[model samples]
Target: MVKFYQHTFSFEHAWDNVTYAFWLRYPNPFASHVIGCDVIDRHVDPDTGVLRTTRLIHKQGVMPRWGRHLIKNADAYIVEESEVDPKTQTMVTRTKNLNHVRVMQVEETLTFTVHPENPKWTQVKTEARIVSEMRWGLTGRVENFGITKFMDNSVRARKGMAHILERLRHNAALAGTPVAAAATTGAPLDC
Candidate 1:
């Protein structure tokens, strides 16, 4: 069985700042489970002028009592791919687990763009799919667990982004530049 989840939310920050915050979202207080993240490849498309990045993330897994026996290693590896188009002012990111596909697989995609009603704010749309093919009548229970864990992780990821955005705003303020302007000017923060 497969479980799907979708959510739409807004960040009270400019789209540029929101996208920038995404790069620094890790190591935040809310995402303590994220142990390490590394950029495997990054480049700009010369023809389209879009920046593309591929990253690998290592996260410590937290399994339920019933699931502990299913998964031997309490760790997960995720692959994240993202594209940023400055001309269109849009960013799209997709992430999925690279391991433990037999037990369960969780895939997520997020899109960021300027809010329609408020240009100063950014809108984010999130979509996720969870699937489990475990036999012995464990498919339903495993899929349920996958969906619940995905939702909880989504909340933490948002909080982590917010924390980074606030820090960027504070630093921009101290530098006598608005966050929006800093994003446009590519001004470096003193942090």
Candidate 2:
């Protein structure tokens, strides 16, 4: 069986700023489990003008103590792929673990866009699916644990993004540039 989760949230910042923050969300205090992140591939689609990126993230101490015997290592790798379309002011990202499929697999997708009621604000939709194929009546327990952990991680991820967004706002102010102007002009962010 698979467990699913969905949520919608908004940030009090512009869509451009929110999308920019997504690229700099790692290494925050809220995500101390993240050990390293590397960009494996990045390029702009010639026809669509959409920016595409693939990243590999290394995380440690992610496994629960009860399940430690099933997996040899406490470390895990995740593959993240994202597409950003500046014209439409939309960004979509998908991520999934690269190891430990037998115990459980968690896949998450996030979409960012401008809020309908407020142009200066950004809306985000998050969806996730967690599945476990383990036998001996352990499937349900494994799936429950996966979903719970996923929810906790989601909260941490949001806090990390908020932290990065606030930093961007402060830097923009110091540079004497409006956040919207900096986002629209594609100014290089300090992140």
Candidate 3:
């Protein structure tokens, strides 16, 4: 058996009272692998008074192929600068023990910054890490181990990403800002 995996990071560095959101999708698999994530859902510091909220979803596959066992089709969603429960108190909140998955570890961090255009706007930064392991034993024990498990992990990521892009367009319309090409000279690098 072999393992395949991918890593990605994204952020909205500058905006006025903006709510950023996006999703991440993993196209392959990893064995005994670690997945780490940090989300800065909200921030109110001396420098920045910005707020961010995120929702993450993950799905994994466990099946045996004709030639070898493999894991495929994992996805995640990270909605930023949304909203949160006032009762809760944390710069970053995480959903540990993701359902029907083996999670070895999870960690996160959030940083705050103040926006010049709107002092009410806050710049938020976050980093997250996750660790996971392959689980083929369960499927192998089942009656049909040959059935391919096309786990769709990116459902939330897809929804969030689309929502954020749409919102950005709407905001631009309200501000009467001209739309530019998707790949502009000043566009941020997609990592």
In model 2, residue pairs whose N, Cα or C atoms come closer than 3 Å (at least 3 residues apart or on different chains), thus clashing, are: none
Task: Give candidate 3 misplaced runs (Cα > 4 Å).
Answer: 1-16, 20-91, 95-97, 100-103, 109-122, 131-171, 174-191
TM-score for all models, in order of appearance: 0.94, 0.93, 0.30
lDDT of 3 at 64: 40
Candidate 3 lDDT over residue span 15-110, tens digit each? 221223222212213211214334433343433443444544333333345413332433333333333222231234334334423422233344
On TM-score, the leading prediction is: 1
Model 1 — which ten-residue stretch has the worst lDDT?
Answer: 182-191
Candidate 2 structure quality by residue, lDDT tens digits, 1-191: 99999999999999988998887777799999998888888899999999999999899856677787888987889899999999998999999989888888889999999999999899999999999989989899999998898889889889999998898889889999887676667554222
Each model's backbone clash number: 0, 0, 23
Q: List the residue pairs that clash in candidate 1.
A: none
lDDT of 2: 0.88
lDDT for each candidate structure: 0.89, 0.88, 0.34
**Residue 36, candidate 1: how far off, in angstroms?**
0.6
